[model samples]
Target chain A: MDKKKINCLSSAISIHNLSKTYASGFVALNNIDLEIYHGEIFALLGPNGAGKTTLINIICGIVTPSEGTIMVDGHNTLTAFRAARSRIGLVPQELSTAAFESVLNTVNFSRGLFGKASNPTYIEKILRELSLWDKRHEKIVALSGGMKRRLLIAKALSHEPQILFLDEPSAGVDVKLRRDMWLMVRRLRENGVTIILTTHYIEEAEEMADRIGIINNGEIIMVENKAILMNKLGKKQLALTLQNPLSTLPSELEKFNLSFSDGGKVLIYTYDAQQEQTGIPELLQQLGEHGIDFKDLNTSESSLEDIFVSLVKEK
Target chain B: MNFYAIRAIYIFEMSRTWRTLMQSIASPILSTSLYFVVFGAAIGSRMGEIDGISYGAFIIPGLIMLSLLSESISNAAFGIYFPKFSGTLYEVLSAPISSLEIVMGYVGAAASKSIILGLLILMTAQLFVDYEIMHPLWMITFLILTSITFSLFGFIIGLWADDFQKLQIIPLMVVMPLTFLGGAFYSIDMLPEPWQTLTLFNPVVYLISGFRWSFYGIADVNVAISLGMIFGFMLLCLATIQWIFKTGYRLKT
Candidate 1:
């Protein structure tokens, strides 16, 4: 293959113009176009019912798309389902395990399902990485919720898929499990496996993702590099507690996008973080010229959560 | 043809049977034995004979068919339904195996279990009465064919049904009644003209009659017709499953 062809094929997953309208006439996804580079952690951040699971399920081939096409490792997902699916692993959102089967056997069975030869050593390594090795002989029903979630991850990785999708992996878990999950995700990325996770947790995306995609109402609103998105959309707010309450803003302050609240006891100004200058000095000089004295002032930078809510609310 | 995937699913299903031995194996055996004690010994002694064969020997094949049909459907249905209910079916669906492999694994395991139970009932029936097998090869052929056909039927039911009640409704209300009225314990031949004609419409009658003929060399339907009916039913089940997989019926969307 040529270098360009190899680079295009190197994409772990590529989706184009994908849409799904369920049988009940509910459109779960609009036309979506995305490309996930190999060996990167991509987090799909969306609120509940934003078609996050629907999109993930389509990529994993669990759900069929009504239109468009998807490719995994350059193989068409629908036409070459087996080849495409062999490269992808999905840890579904729900917690489901064979209660009667032992952990070791379940993982082995999952590996065999992908037409992979038995590799006891690889299986052992996965179980150990997930800290499920000690409970290998125990039935899944006997494990706690955290352990069962970990087991789901183990099963997804059983076939050693190049691309792993963790759908809401930390939906309802303790702090310790969340920590362990991210740690394991990092370890996997170090080994060059592409990871795609869907989550409602903004902090998880901020902490783990190289790129973030925000979905809302069956449409992907934005996709950008985490650092770039933060720098571009991050907003800082400056709030001032006035010594004397004002009935209204002065005509001189009309040029500034300022707002008064708490019956004019406080004044607030918002500015973009990525601007060459915040214009804080100009704001203070204008405030002094207007004879608006403040008791105290504070500045705070908005987190990703704030940006996400405003983006969704804008739609 | 992913034999490894098929073997994995088959072994997983078979292991479930061993886990629920009392319910899957023991219960059916004990229930079939009770049928033998009540129908074969108690009723046969007073009923004289059916055709040229003694009443005790005559009901043996019918009784085995009764258990075989019900057990085959219930076993296959439950085997597939539990995975769907528990949400573990996604793992199998997302795997690299084809739909045909999945059906073969599930139906094959269910049919094997039913066949083993059917043969065990045959051995147990011998303790109650001496039954002659006029064509042993035919008997074996019918046993396997009936187990597989009914197992496939059960697999379809498992996919179509959305709840536990739907699962039980067909086998309990429909299958058991048909088995009883299909000449399991008595020949349809003895019934009056209208009743006999009505009984022939019941598909289970063909199965029981064919199996009984294998034992006593007598039949209510021709042996060739019986075999044809079974193959026809098997083909129907296969077609339905193929459509289900292709359309992504309940499993995909």
Candidate 2:
């Protein structure tokens, strides 16, 4: 199965020069180019009204593109939409569902809607995986909000799509359910499904994403491996407590313009963690030469959330 | 072709009708029965015969058309409209099925329901007034054609409507009035002067006349003209649907 997927495709999804402009002249998405690989969990991070939903909608064929084209597994989303859409599934952000429909029937409806034949055994498998089998006979309106979110996942996976787009899957969900969703996502990746999700929860991406992409103001600012992003952009801070208070930094450290707090009783230095020369050694040597002594020294590294905040702030 | 997808939608919609049995089948049948009791049994008796057929029997086809048009429109309209109202339309729009298949599934189901309701009314009318079918096959044909035509129109109303009030505007304000004035209770011959000639302008007149001709072999308009008018209205509806899909008017952003 893995060999067949790569026989003719370079990437699972490829977007080129994509843009969407509403009739009201609102540019929902700018010229965007991106490539998503197979068997990888990619998380898209963005703030409110940042075009995350619009981008996901366009790729899923729910919204038409004003200009440019999208191909899903080498199939153009428009020209060969049947071939393209059959291999993809989308779990929308809204909790809008058939309030009167049974959970089992609605899931079956989605599978048939994607042109797949009936497979009760397979449907039962997904239902059990989402922990919805017990509530399968209940109407969707009877389930709790968390269960409805899980039902959306069951519907998306009903047809066994190769690529899944979950738009804010964890929104309004409890911690236990979020963890369960993350575990399910990882399991899907292991089975060779390419997953793309947009989330405001930095921890979700930090824990689940193999790669991360940050989008802001309708444009993608950066896309990098999760580990590489954290390391490259992660800033480390060194805090030193002085043995005696000083009026200010010595003349030799004036060029660095180091930050001092607590009435000059403490000194702080920040530098890139990944760089070979973080300037920490140079600063300490200069401090020793200047006779600036500290009784205590501690270092702190920034988390993924800090990096995300700084990146969005920069743009 | 996505026949499997089409079947799924068709079955889903049909099940909605089954779930709301009182509204879908019983309400229309009960109301049509009321018309038979008042007009076909009471007023129709004193009204006496016209063109050799009893007044009660003459209005049977017209009464069936009245319910057929309204039921077809509302069934198709509400079936699609509820999904939009509840935000479930996204799933249908994003599905791999084509627009044509979507129409077939919805319109097909609505028309089937209307035809069944029409036949049920026809049988119920027999209890109030005795009637004969001069052309049984043509009677069934008119039932099928009128149901399909009005169902397509209803689908358009569903797509165009944004609210519940808008959904009812066409069926209540437009279709019901037209049917009432389309000679549903009396033949155009009873009207005075140019009014009889002017009645041709009402499109419903053709539908009711063609259907009456199928029942009693008597009609105000020629059978061919009535058939042509029905086909014309259906084509206009089909063209409008094609334009809607092409522009992605209400379905897409």
Candidate 3:
């Protein structure tokens, strides 16, 4: 049996031991394995130079991998590349388009290149969905940055691919545009199109991804359901403003490992936010028993941004 | 195998020719006419026939070969290079179409454009002086073969070039010089001694000779050798292209 040739029984994309080493000997991706299930919005979260685009390009067939086996929709990326590629469409991070070609013509060209029959109605639908139908006849050079981005999405969706990759789709997008793009992504997912988007924006992933995969320094550090990941990695901080400044803390309250700042004006305790017993009430009672009194108290829960920053910073 | 993809690329490239009609189709005809006037009407009328064919008519095929070579190279080179430069080639590279299909689309369109331009120049030659294509079918064959072969060569240049200047280097510096010296304006047989043997090493000589043979049934080299040279060059280009896709050359990294 060939260990490298693993079956993708249920994975939309199954990557096994993927690694890409460029001619310069720089390892862009190293010993990575990931699986994206069908009909889900999977956000690949990573920072600058984090191999997000390299991974997307490899899966999309633009960049070849030095070592790995990638199966796209049950087709091997190397041996059955045509089948694999036909099933996927990629909206690259760069804003590349033909300046002289019209918007509609470019979409039609993309569909044809992907071996799809010409469908004017489908092209029009995607264009209109992306708010590009009105500018269809205009030369791409005349379009604004936002319209051009929309045109890229239109072209990617032109072929009705089973899997779509959006590499930093929201790089230069506005709030409204981003909202609309997400709406369209939702519509695609509703139609059973698997979407794997790469974004450094934690908010984008938090709002859209069903599952989140955090990649850092050419490796995937974590993959989990969005809610479970946030809950697990997130932190909660309890801050207490003392009624009086204290020169020192009593050893009875030391068990909580609490720290004081602002000249002992505030005491802080950090704990896992996801745990059923956060020890918050016990800590408060212990402080009370230790004769520590606070005038007011506040609590803060970490966002996905904090989790992402901590993850990358740790790596 | 993807006929639709091939048609799409071919139509896209052909439309570009239409958009730049002045530069693509018209300019070549205007330049070839100048060649017929200076080299044909001016010089040929003052000179005697070579191999019993009039000097003006003798240079017709060579003159067309000159433009065909340069046009085929530049057209295909620019067709692929511009996409690479502008970064739009990612879609095509990521598309399901095979490497062979992409080559067929680009080289096919470039050859078709050169063939049209070559035929137009052949027609323009009629206004200058009288001539006859002794083997009309062979004339079409030579025109097509040369266009396709040179277009394949140009596709290699496109893949090899990283910058716009590099793209022009082969067409302007290398191919142009070769065609001019490869018996386009004069017969290599007219050369003296080892120079004539040296001229045979220029592959363009065979192309021009074979193209001229189709016109006047006179050739400096055997027609079979000319065909072999063009086919041989074409096979090399094809193999290079295959290696390019296999290695993920400039197109991938």
Candidate 4:
């Protein structure tokens, strides 16, 4: 391949104004624009029925869109499907391996699906990496759920695609396997493979994603760097235990956006993390001046899940 | 579509079907044998010979037709339908393989199973009665043509079916009735004039009659007309299946 082509291949996938609507008049995906940077872990976060799978389907060329265009490594997905699909590997949400087929054959055949010649050494390495070498000759039906999930990953990576799409890779997986998958994903990214993942587990996205895109109602609500999204959208809470239970808040404490909780025994303050001078010290000083005292105090920062819920609810 | 991808899918389908190998290979052969014993031996003994061929040999073509028609449609339809119902079709559709590759892999396996069953019944028939072949080439031609035609029909049925019940509706309701009424057990010539004329509308009659002519060198209907009917049905099936693929009919939604 030419160097220019190789360079183009590194930039993986680009989508512009893509949309999909079923004939039943249900719009599964709205006009969505996204670009997955080369060699990065990009997480698509959405709740159920939010069009994450539909977006993946459009990118993989499995479902045709009603409008717009997608380019995989600069190859038009519609006209140059073979080339576009050859560069991308998709591990679908369903476990679809042939039940009677041996693990080795399943992965080897998936490699051949993209017109790749046999490379037993490469396949062996993939199986070994996925901890499937011991079960190489075992039929898929005999494998456990985690083993089946690993087999799906092995199959996807067999073709050595530049970009890999994992649609909810850990939906039903155990904690051990989920961690193993995260490690494997990190390794793949290190090897210069771009990964686009859709996940309902907020922590999975927070732990593994370099960037996060939130999709809702068939549209992308926001896409931001992990740090930036958290800093810009996250909130902080201050809890103050009072010396005495109060029936009502003091008018002076109104500036702290305070609320009573724990049967009026505690006062809570909510503030944006991105704002300078959260004014906690000033609030406490004012409370002391008012002859009010807190027996205990603590603060809690917002999590990715909180930000995600807020964003979805806002839309 | 690439040949490697086609081969991969073909091997996958064959592996999946291997679990029911006994049922797949034995059911049609056993049914054909029972037809020979009950219809050919018991019934034919009283009816005597027709067109100078023994009653036992007279029903050979019809028995083979029954196996070919039923096995061809069920094998193809069930093979595709199970994958779709089990959600494995999503894996296949998302793979790099094209629609043509998917069809070839499935239809090829279906045709292979139907041909094997057809040959198995033919061999079993040899143990009870011997049948002469006037045109060996035509015998193979009609067998393959019927298998392809019915396999294509089953493919369409598979695509159209959304549930397991719907998948079986075509074979149980349509195929079984058509095979019985299309003169699979007796010659249409034995029927009254009006019934014989109505039997001409049955597509399986043309297939069996053409195949019987290949074996006995004589048929109730003109061999040319039978061949034309079979070919016409094959073309219609091919056009419809191709349209389904092009439009991503049931496969997409």
Instruction: Enumerate clash totals for all models, in the order shown.
Output: 0, 0, 0, 0
Error of 3 at A246 (Å): 6.2
lDDT per residue as tens, model 3, A1-315: 011221222589999999999899999999999998887889999889999999999998889998989999889998998899999989989999999998888999999999988999989888888888888899999999888888998899888899999999999889999999999899898898989999978899998998899998899999888887877788999999999988788777777788888989999999987788989999888878888899999999899999999888988
Query: What is the i-RMS of every prediction?
Result: 0.8, 0.8, 0.7, 1.8
Kindly report the TM-score of the first chain in candidate 3: 0.92
Q: Which portions of model 2 miss their true places by more than 4 Å?
A: A1-9, A241-257, A260-267, A285-297
Q: lDDT tens string, model 1, B1-253?
A: 8888988888898988898999998888899889788878888788888788988898899889989999999999998898999999989888888999999899999999999999999999889988879999999999999999999999999998889998889999999999999998888878998999999889999999999999999998898999999999999999999999999888889
Candidate 2: the clashing residue pairs are: none
Error of 4 at A183 (Å): 0.3
Model 3 residue A134 lDDT? 87
What is the docking quality class of candidate 3? high
- Highest DockQ model number: 3
lDDT (CA) per prediction: 0.91, 0.91, 0.91, 0.85
Those runs of model 1 whose alpha carbons end farther than 4 Å from true positions after fitting are A1-9, A240-249, A260-266, A291-298
> lDDT (0-100) at residue A197 of candidate 1?
96
Candidate 4 CA-lDDT value: 0.85
Tens digits of per-residue lDDT for model 4, A134-252: 99999999999889989989988999998999999997899998999999999898888999999999999999998899999999999888877888998999998989988776788
DockQ of each: 0.81, 0.81, 0.82, 0.51
